[model samples]
Target: MRQPGGDEDGTEPGDGEPGSRLAALGGLHLEEAPPDGGVPATGRSPRTARNRTLIVSALLAATLIACLGTAVHLFLRINEPSSAERPPPPPPPRPGASMSGPAGGGPRPVAQPVRTENDLDMVCADRFYPSAPRFRGSAPHPVMISEGEETGADFRSTRTLNRAAFAGSATQRRTWAPDPERAQIVACLDLTGPGRKIRDCRAGDGTLPLVEGRYRLAVYEVATRRRILQKDLTGTDRACPFVIRTGAGDTLHSAVKDQQLYDLLHQRVEG
Candidate 1:
């Protein structure tokens, strides 16, 4: 419904307001001229308004993109561990001692005994040679025991090797462990050093330091629990073949070298 007073806002005819009068007469309003009579200053063009909206939208989009990029960079920097965040590398593998696991088992770490001296002075680079005569008859299976309360390695790996060796060998392979009191022969421990830590273990000029333990071991006939033979007994009986030296100050003072002890019995005693 067209109002009689004006187009909509109630402006009458012949009013000085050109805009309202023109709007009442026609839909288009008159453009007001500039002060210098140059181009007219009119209402904002739709195209120019649309261009400004597009530019503002583009700027906001770019800002949003930059913000996202910065956020992603910060996330990576936070998640990625720095040198301080990373754990220290494991200590490098030790040197010298190179023994591996025992036979028939997976890799058994050669557990080093407590920190003893990593080195020893071979006062005499003495080879194993006992001066006693080779006795007749079969050698008994040695029931391995030790000098103190069995703790630490107790030379356990050596014992593991010995047990495994006996289990594998023919000459001294007795399934039953022999009683020291009742058995015909017993290899008893006579002395042991501070493992591989003793400064000088040599008792005499030619005798070996009681390194691991068996260097001073004695073979005794149980009836008379006296020493029938020491490391000095004749015919190639060894003092102790010093075992291996492992990583970082790891060493074996008197680890028996191999299964040669039973092999010696295999060589000597008559049936």
Candidate 2:
């Protein structure tokens, strides 16, 4: 072979080029091989591996610490008392128990008794009638009568009398016949003892002599002692009279009727 520079052998300008197949074939070029066996790795090296090992070890230690902390917290919570299951205790009371001071106190004051209507009626009776024997006599004409139930509101004790009984005496004495006027008077004073006193004893007309004093009353009148029977006794003949006796033996009679007796009686009994 001939050389271009007039050398004895044929040789190129790049004689030491690396990875040259021509240089390996000894065609007058020198080539060099790489110092490393192959190409570099795409990722980490041994030092990186050591760093990774320490990083993994640190992460594992952190996980263990976190788990231990969680376990300790759960252990403490399980041992503690639960407010949901327990009930609150009741409050304590004082030693002595009472409404006024403390417990075991004294009694309080009570109210007084009030007077009723019944009490007032009994009082009226006792005040008016104190003597037992003061309402009885003869004509003054006295007729005996018995107690009867006070049915009417006005007149506690009353009965109708025959008008004809006073016909003979009517001409001589100014007398009222058995009418509303006479019945009215009996109604007023009989129960209260006003009817017992007859002052001016004309045959049929008269006034009662009621002195201011306490008197007692008997429930009965005795006409047997008078021996005064109804003579004509016909056509409502004879004196239609009412008689009442006191507890002390005095008797009351009235031929003239008054309304006051009945009114007072009515108020006391039914009302």
Number of the predicted model whose TM-score against the real structure is largest:
1
Top model number, lDDT: 1
lDDT of 1 by residue, 184-203 (tens): 43343322333433333333
Structural similarity to truth (TM-score) of each candidate: 0.27, 0.19
**Residue-wise lDDT of candidate 2 within 1-271, one digit each (tens)?**
6677543555554454565445455433332333584323443456789999999999999999999999999999999789977687776753221111112332222132212222112211221112211223322221112122221112123232333234346421221222221111111112223322324323235443432222122221111111112111001112323443323223223332323222323232222
Off by over 4 Å in 2: 1-39, 84-271
lDDT minimum window of 10 residues, candidate 2 = 228-237
Model 1 compared with the native: what TM-score?
A: 0.27
Compute the lDDT of residue 218 as modeled in candidate 2. 25
CA deviation > 4 Å runs, candidate 1: 1-48, 75-82, 89-250, 258-271
Candidate 2 — what's its lDDT?
0.30
Clashes of each: 7, 40
